[model samples]
Target: LLCQILHCLLILLQLVEIVLFIVDSGCSKHMTGNLKLLINFVEKFMGTVKFRNDQIAPILRYGDLVQGAVMIKRVYYVEGLNHNLFSIGQFCDADLEVAFRKSTCFIRDLKGNDLLTGSHGTDLYSITLQDTNCPNLICLMAKATSSQAWLWHRRLSHLNFDTINLLSKNDIVTLHAYFATEGIHHQTSIARTPKQNSVVERH
Candidate 1:
């Protein structure tokens, strides 16, 4: 009877050991899964950080600068035109000139016409100066389409344009090419001038 009792105790201890081993294995698997998830998250976050700093922020800053400079120049030109018109007895108050100037000024994706008539365009120019993940100006321009340009402008109005004209030809080309390729497909309302669309027919 004593021997039988000893045997039973040994079996119980073995079962307990087996149970402990199973629990340990399950805990190890859970830890591995958590580590994998953490690693993936870190990788994605790093990629986004690199892109924002290297590409998106600079393009946005440059775009804002260019738009601002253009706005100031246009304002001066409009003022001169208004003065000339008034002097010639065109019968126009300065308010009209101010309105025209405001209309022509491109701010937050609203073009001159949009400001004048509240008829917003399908696309608006936008830029991000700092902490942007995507630096490609073309991609930024492409985002300013009929669907989301207005919303994006509303979100990013705080950005300032300091010296946008200094952007290189390559950057401009990149933007223009993107517009030509993608924008052309969507711009059915924009009729090209005959000279602009002329093509030589194959003989």
Candidate 2:
């Protein structure tokens, strides 16, 4: 009975290791302690970071997290970082718009196109991003449709394109690429500009 209980505890620990990332408006870049989550990782001397708990961690290198067709590029490595983090500032820098409701987080391209959706936990917009190469999925987030995006939009408070520019980062490009691979066209053509063709829209 003791051995069985130990085994059960080990399994539960493994299950809880599922990456829990907080979408942080305060953080400047995506950060994670698990180097295994990164691909094409490059070793370099970056710097150090002071976590919210007043504990400090070292930033060793940077890499990309390739998921399906999307690559979250330039994720910084902070060994034993207190918590995995998604940077709203970084997302905003990439021309992505982020909005929050009571329990759902919405990410969109500037064209009002949905890119990613995350659920809100007690105090964090916890977005789980799975690593494609790993056999065990770390962060398992929901994949959404356009209607889902509109639904979340209706739930948001006073924020909108007219009021806020939203989160960003270069990774937004890879996300857009992922959408393209999935047959979701986000680009529209300019009027009277026949040379610029528009991609067909799919439901």
RMSD of 1: 32.2
TM-score of 1: 0.15
Name the regions of candidate 1 deviating beyond 4 angstroms: 1-150, 158-173, 183-203
User: Model 2, 1-203: lDDT tens per residue?
Assistant: 32232222211011223566788988989999888788898999788899768888778899987654656778999987868788998888888898999999977889987667789877779877654444442332333354464443444343344332221142212435545577755554645423335633365
Task: Highest TM-score: give the candidate number.
Answer: 2
Model 1 agreement with the true structure over 1-203: per-residue lDDT tens digits: 32232222211011111000001111111111111111112121111111313432111110111111222111101111111101101101212221223223212222333211111122321111122222433323224444654566465453332322223232432333544554333243755523335642211
lDDT agreement of model 1 with the native: 0.22
Clashes of each: 12, 9
Models 1 onward score TM values of 0.15, 0.55
